[model samples]
Structure formats: C-alpha cells, structure tokens
Target chain A: MVLHIMADALFISVAILTIGSAIVALETRELVYGAIGLAISMMGIAGFFLLLDSPFVAMFQITVYVGAVAVLVIFTVMLVRTQALFSIKEDPRRKTAGIVLLLVFIGGIGAVVLASGLGNPAFTKFNKPAIDVATIGKQMVTYYAPVLVLLGLTLAASVIGALALARREDIEQKNERVD
Target chain B: MATVPEEFRFGNFLASIIWVILIVIVLLTLVILPLTFIVLFYVPLPPVNGEVLTPYLFLTMIVDPTRTLPIVKYLIHTTPFKVIVFPGFVFAAIIAAATIFVERKFLAKMQLRVGPLYAGVWGVGEGILQLAADGLKVISKEILIPSGADKPIFWAAPIAFVATAAAVVALIPVAPGWVVSNTDVGLIAVFAILGFFPLIALLFSWASNSKYPFIGGLRALHQMIAFEIPFILSALSVVILAGSLNLTHIATSQHPFWFILFLPISAFVFFISSLAELERVPFDLPEAESEIVAGWLTETSGMIYGLIQLGSYLKVYALAALFVILFLGGWSGPQIFPHQLGPPDAIPLVKVLTLQGLYNAVTVNAIFWFLVKTIVIIMLMLLPRGISPRIRIDILLHTGWYKLIVLAFVNMFVALALIYAGVLGPGGSLSIH
Candidate 1:
C-alpha cells in the first residue's frame, strides 16, 4: 500500500516536472535555455517510461532524444547569432493560432484516450510482466525486420542527404579553385 | 585595506569551541532527539532474527555487543548499504581516488619525475596521502564564479557530472550480485547514462559564457557524440556474443574463455572509443590546457574543478571496469582464496570479527580479480597520456566516425560468424551452459 502511494507520488511529480520543463522550453527567451528545458522535459518523459515499467524504452528515450537531439539543438542554438537567441518577436495572431492549436491537440488527445478505454481500471492495470529486450530483439528480427530495415534505410539516407547539404558550399569553393 | 587583524588567542578559541559544542548539545537534545523519536515511532521496523525490532530493542542491541551481529548483518543487506558503501559510491570514489594518485605517479615516472613526494608518512609511501591533502585543500578553497555566468547551472553542473558518473558506477558489477542497480538492459543503461556527460559539458561551458569554454564545449559535444556510435557498436558485438544485455550475465558468459580471444578488434575499438569518450590523452581536446585554457572547465575553481576531476576519474574507473567485464572475463581467475579463512569450528567471536556471515571466499576472489584487471586497464589508459600528444579535433572526429566504427563493425561480423559456426552461444561447442 505504501509502495503504491509512493509510486503515485513519483508519477505525479514526474508529470509535473515534464510539463513544467516543456512550458519553460516554449516560454524561455534564451534559445540555449529552451534547449536545456527541452532536454529536461524529455528526461521527464523517460521517467514516465520508467514508471510504465519499460526501462529499455526509457533508456532509449534518454539516449536518442535528450542525449543526441537536444544536444544538437543546443549546439546549433549556440552557433547562431547571440542577439537572435533572446529575441522572439511576438504577434497577436501567432499567439491566438498557437492557443487554438494547443487546445485542438489537447482535445484530440483527450478524445483518443476516451475512445481507447484507457481510462478504465481494467485497461490501466498491468498484470503481465514487462517484455524483455531479448524478446523484443527476436520480434524485431522475425516479424518487424522489413520495417526495421526500412527505418534504418531512411535514417541512413537522411544522414547522407544532410552531409551532402552541408558539404555543398565546400564543393562549390573547390570548383571555383579548380576554375 | 592592508590592515593586520588582531593576533590569535588560544583562550578565545577554546571559549568559541565550547560555545559551539554547547549549542550542538542543546540542538541534539531539543530538536534532533525529538525529531528522531517522532520519525521512528511512525516508521516500520524490520524483523531481526525472527523477532520484531522495536526502538527499545534497537537501543538494547546498540548497548549489547553480543546482539549487534544480526543488526549489522541486516544493515549490510539494506539498499542504502549497497548504494552507499559496497559496489556503489564509496567503492567507486575510492577507486577514482586511487586512479588519480596512480595516474599522477605513473605519468610522473613516464615523464622522468618524482610525483607527490611530500604527502605520505615520512615519504615512506612516496605520496599515498596526496589525494587526502588535495581533497582538503580543494574543499577549503573558495569557489569562484564569473560575474555574468549563469549562477544555477554553474553551481549545479559539477554536482550533475558526479551524480551521472555515480549512476553509471551503480550499473557496473564488481562481483556477481554486487551491482547496485542490476537492470536487465545494463549495457544500454550505461550508454544512456554516458550520454549525459556531453550535455553537462556544454551546459557548463555555456554557463561560463567565455570564448575558450564555448569552443571547448563544442569540441566535447562533437567528440563524445562522434565516438558514441563506435562505443555502442563495439559493445553490441559483445552483446551479440553473450546474447544477453545484463552486464553480470555477459561477464559470467565468458567463463570458458574471455571475449577478447574472439573479438580482439572489438576490444581494441572499445578501448579507443572509451578513451575518446573519457577525453583522455590523445583525445583530451576538450581540455587541451595549452590551446583552450582547460576547455569547458576554464571557469571552474576550487571544489568545482575538483568535482569535475573526480567525475572524470570515476568515469575512467567505470569504463575500464566495463572493458574488463566485457573482454577480460570479469572476476574469472584461479581459485586463490581458500574455502574458509580458518577452521570451521572457530569461536563465534573470531567468526564475527572476520565477518564470516558477509564474507564468501568466492566473492572475495571475484572482487580481487576484478579490481586487478580494472587497475591494469586503467594503467594502460594512463600510459597514452605520457607518450602521445592530443590529436587535432578534425582527426579525432574522423577517427571516431570512420576508423573505430569500421573496426567495431568488422568485429560484429566476426561475432556473428562465431555464433553461426557453433563456436559459442546456446548449445554450441564451447558453450559453458
């Protein structure tokens, strides 16, 4: 009983932290701070994954999102013009549109949750053991192999495309030198 | 401004000490005792020796020396004990401290100099106490923050670094069942924890708001991120060989032969990538002292710097231990430890003194071997600092992205070939289980 209460409290706290950081990310003026806030929010999401008893997913969330993506965002933010980091020119129209979009998102999420029966006690209760990494790996190989391969190919292609885009200026400079 | 203060007085010092002691005693009696009593009243106590242990019984056990063994045994098995004492913070910290001293002495010898000669007992150990002295000095020194620095992150980054390092340490198994947090995906969890270091570095440098630190932070980001792929890929080969992600299981899987025998290229790649991840020697561009003024750590002073060093050395210990666990057949050695320390019918007092209940010969042997292998690996890691200069950033990135990844992939194929050839893995020719 005590453990359950503690778990609930932990869940509530993690939810608060995630939401608060996400808000901070959106609201903060400094781009670097926003990036850090985003990282923290992702960490909170990882914590949620931990609460859901999917530590593998939690670790992956941290590794990919907080570790790589957020760091990349921060790096780019830091490299930009210092003056631009703190400046956000607010418009009334944009703010109204943002609020409308947010409300629509929240409503859509709420509708999905209601329709999916996630609110039901039976649906929420997890009696089965969490899936192990080995089982997941096996499933990936046997069942989801094509999807996995496609995902890998997409990621690889994107990486190559990004490299090409980044190196275009260098290539042009080299051509000029040759001329 | 240069005015001299009054001379020190022994009487005044004594009086001040007495006053402080009196205040502490008063606080203990008035505030702390009641708080403890109130807290203990509501808290559930565990049974000791099949008896419910109340506050009175706890006090009695404290007073009666004979009844203390059970309590000690119980305490040893507690989560706090595992996390704080064995296989956790204290253990890792001690290893980190030792590594620091050893690195200093080892590097000094390599550079043809005597290191830390004034700290040990009459120079008998030649500087064994240097770490203690350094710790004291750093703790006593003032922490300096730059004027426009982000105060919160500047203060928090060092602590976060250490905490992250400790989290990684908690996942590592010193001996069988000796890990603090024994997760199923321990390898992935380690990689996850390691991913935070670069973030911490960048944040700290940004907080510092200095040119050099900014450059250093970017280098750290690039270096750590570039090497991460190779690090994961190299470990993936080990994972493929072991067919389990749990570090303990991986270690135990190598009972018949170490993974290095089969995946030498993976081991080599792992070592190099770990060096890059750790930012040691040939990969210490982030903290290249001559070029970048301590890199991301430019603004850190006193205990802040100390904490970062401690974190990095803890990282060094962790990665070296990981390498040992992955490739060197962790804790598998000749049975040097006896089945029992003394006669089985020895006196209870002798048994208690030797901690017979807690001490297993097998565990002791495992720990000894693990430590020995980890130390050797650590020494190997330190050796590069003495011989090689730090590489350029572009070269470091290129090596991490191109060479190490290719090497790791080559070994992954080799691991696959072995698995298919029935040389290892389930029901294979050389499989132990």
Candidate 2:
C-alpha cells in the first residue's frame, strides 16, 4: 500500500513539474530562462519514461533533448548577443484564435482518453515485462529496418547540406569596392 | 535610527513580540498542520520490525544494538546508503581526491620539480595534505559575483555541475549487485548524463556575462559535441562484442579474454575521446589559462571554482570506472576468494557485526579486481596531463570530428567480422556465458 501511494505521488509530482515547465517555457520573456524551462520539461518527460519502465528511452531522452537539443538552443540564443529580450504584443483576435485552438486540442485529447479507456491496468498488461535493450535492437533491425535506413540517409543529406551552406560565399574582386 | 531606539522602548518591543508570536501560531496551525496531513495521507507508513516505525521509535532503535542490526541492514540496502556512502558520491569523491594528490606528486617527479612542498601546517607529512589545505583556503576566500552577472544562474551553475556528475556516478556498478541505481540501460544512462556537462558549462559562462567566457563557452560546446559521436561509436563496438547494453553483463562477458585485445582500435578511440571530453592536457583549449585567462572559468571565484573542480574530478573517476567495466574484464580474475569464511553459524558476533553471509566469495573478489582496474585506468588518464601540451582548438575539433569517428568505425567493422567468423559471441567456442 505504501509503495502504491508513493508511486501515485511520484506520478503526480512529475506531471506537475512537466506542465509547469512547459508553461514557463512558453510564457517566459528571457530566452535563456525559457531554454532552461525546456530542459526541465525534458527531464520531467524522462521521469515519466522511468515510471513507464522504459529506462533506455528515459536516458536517451535526457541525453538527446536536455543535453544536445537544449544546449544547441541556448548556444544560438547566446550567439545573438543580448541579455534581455523584448516580446511584441499580439492582437486580441490572434489571442482569441490561439485560445480556441488550445481548447479544441484539449477537448480532443479528453475525448480520446475517454474512448480508449486508458489507465485500466488490466487493459495494458499484456506482456507485463520490461523490454530489454537487445530485443529493442533486434526489433529495430528486423521490423523497422527501412525506417532506420531512411533516417540515416536523411541525416547524411542534412550534414552535406549544412556543409554546403556553411561554405564561404565568393564574389568577384572587380565587383567589390575597396574600403 | 537614534530617534527610533529612543522612542522604541518596551512598548514597541512587546508589540513586535506579540505580532511575531501571533504569526508563528497562525502559520503552524493553519499551514504546517494541513501540509503534514496531506503528506501523511498520500504516503503510507513503512513497517519496521512488525511495527509502523514511528518517528519516536527511530531513536530507540539506535540504542538497543541487537534490535538495531536488522534495521541497520535494512538501511544499508536503501537508496541513501547507496547514494551517499558505498559506490556513490563519497566513494567517488575520495577517489577523486586521491587522484589529485597522486597526479601532483607523480607529475612533480616526471618534471624534476618539487610539487606542493609546504601546503598545510609547517609542511608536515611532506605536503601529502595539500588538497585539504587548498580546499580550506578556497573555502575561506570570498565568492565574488560580477555586477552585471545573472545572479541566479551564476549561483546555481556550479552546484548543478556537481549534481550532474553525482547523478552519472549513481549509474555505475562497483561490484555485482552492489550498484546504486541498477537498470537495463546503465551505459546509455551514463552517456545521457554526460550530455549535461556541456550545457552546464555554457550556462555558467553565459551567466558570467563576459567576453572571454563567451568565447570559452563556444569552444567547450564545440569540443564536447564533436567528441560525443566518437565516444558513442567506440562504446557501440563494445556493446556489439558483448551483445549486451547492461554494464554488469558486459563486464561478466569478458571473463578470460579482455575486450581490449580484440577491439584495440575501439579502445584507442575511446581513450582519445575521453581525454577530449574531460578537457585534459592535450585537449583543454576551453580552459587554457595562458591564452584565455582560464577560459569559461575565469570569473568563478572561491568555493564556486572548488565545486567545478570537484565535479570534473568526479567525472574523471566515473569515466575511469566505465573504461574498467567495459574493457578491463571487471571483477574477473583467478579463483582465489574463499567460498565461506568459516562454518555456518559458528560465530554469532561475526554474523551480527560483519554480516558474514552477505559477503559472498565472488562479490569480494569482484570488488577487488574492479578497484584494481579502475585505479590503473585513472593513472593512465593522469599521465597525459604531465606529458602532452594543449593542442589548438581547430586541430582538436578536426581530429574529434573526422579521425576519431573513422577509427571507431573501423573497429566496429572488425568486431562485426569477428562475430561473423564465429571467433566469439553467442554460441561460439570462446563465449564466456
């Protein structure tokens, strides 16, 4: 009973942290602070993964999202050479439209949850064992091989494109005026 | 101020006292009580020795030594013991301190210079207590914050760096079944935790709000990201050779033949990448004191600098432990440990104090070998600090991005070829399992 109650408390706290950080990330004016909020949100998602018994995914999420992705965002923000950021006020009509869209998305999520009967332990207790990393690798290779190959190709192409884009732009010496 | 003191006699003092009392009473009765009740409702009480182990009884358990043995044993398996004591932060910290001392003395001998001659209290013990003296000096100094710095991040970044390092240490296995947070993905968790250091470094630099720190932070980011791919790739070869992602399983798989012999190229790649990731001698451009005034760490003062240094050393211990576990055939050696110390139930005091039954043959031996291998790896890591000069940033990045990746890939292919030829792995003749 104690374990179950503790588990519930853990879940509630993680849920609150995730939502709070997401809101902070969206609402903050400081670009760096917003990036920190995003990192915290990523950590909360990692906690959820731990609760779901997917340790590998949780660790991977932390490494990739909080470690690499958020750092990249912060690096770019810092490169802009500014401390304080000024946000432009949006029109009332745009605000109203955004609120309506958010409400619709929440309503759709609630409807899906009600229809799926999610949270019934018996309903999702088929295997009941943690998926080992070896099986994950095997499944990825055997069943999801094509998608993995496609991702590899896309990544390779992106690297090439980035290199090309970063190459120094050349102009004719005759066309340029000497300072 | 003088007028207030003159006017404010017992009358004003009594009024303030009454107000303080009222506020404390209201806060305790209204806020604390409800919060306590909420916590009690959400978490059930744990039972200890056929009782709920109430707060009042907690003190009683410490006195009755016989009754306390079970509770003590219980606490040993708990998270606190694992996190704070054995195989965790404290253990790693001690190792880190030792490494600092040894690196100084060893490098001194290598250069014919007397290093740390008189550090503490008139130079007793030949400067052996130098790290302690340095630590005390740092503690005594004032931590200065720049006027334009981000106060919150500047204060929090060093602590965050240390916490991240400790978190990584939690995932490493010291001996069989003796880890703090054992999971199926221990190795991956280490990598994930490692990814945080670059972010923390950049955050600290940005918080300082200085031109030099900005340049240092960029160098750190480039260095860290460039090396991470090669680090992952080299580790992948080990995973392929062992056929397991669990660090403990990988260690056990290398019983008779260490993976270093078969995957030397991968080992070489891992070492080079490790040096870069740690920002050691040959790859320490980010914090190059001569060129960039300690790089990103230029603005850190007093205890903050101490904390960052401690965190880096903790990382050194962790990475050394990982290398030991992966390639040095962790905890495996000749069969020398006894199966049992004596006949079962022969001595009651031994059972109660030493917990003899818990001390199995394989566990003790494994711990011994694991420590032996880890120390050797740490020494190897420290050697380059004395031998090599720091390389240029562009050259360091180029080697990390290009050469190391190719070398790691070549080793991976070699591992695959060995597996296909049936030299090792599952169902092969040399399979340990």
| Top model number, TM-score | 1
lDDT of each: 0.92, 0.87
lDDT of 1 by residue, B221-319 (tens): 889999999999999999999999999999999999999999999999999999999999899999999999999999999999999999999999999
Off by over 4 Å in 2: A81-87, A116-127, A171-179, B1-74, B119-124, B335-361
TM-score of each model, in listed order: 0.92, 0.85
Report the lDDT tens digits of candidate 2 across residue range B1-433: 4556546688879999999999999999999988976665656756775787665555576665545776766677788899999889999999998888888988998999988887646647668889999899999999999889999999999999999999988888988888888778888888998999999999999999898887888889999999999999999999998998888888889887999999999898998888888988889888998889998999999999999999999999999899988888877877587887766665566555655545568877888888888999999999987888899888998999899999999999999998999988997678755
Q: State the weakest 10-residue window (summed lDDT) of model 1 chain B.
A: B350-359
Model 1 misses residue B198 by how many Å? 1.3
Query: So what's the TM-score on candidate 1?
Result: 0.92
Query: How big is the positional error of residue B377 in model 2, measured in Å on the Cα after superposition?
Result: 1.1
Docking class of 2: medium
Write model 1 residue lDDT over A71-101, tens digit each, in one string.
Answer: 8898888778868545677799999999999
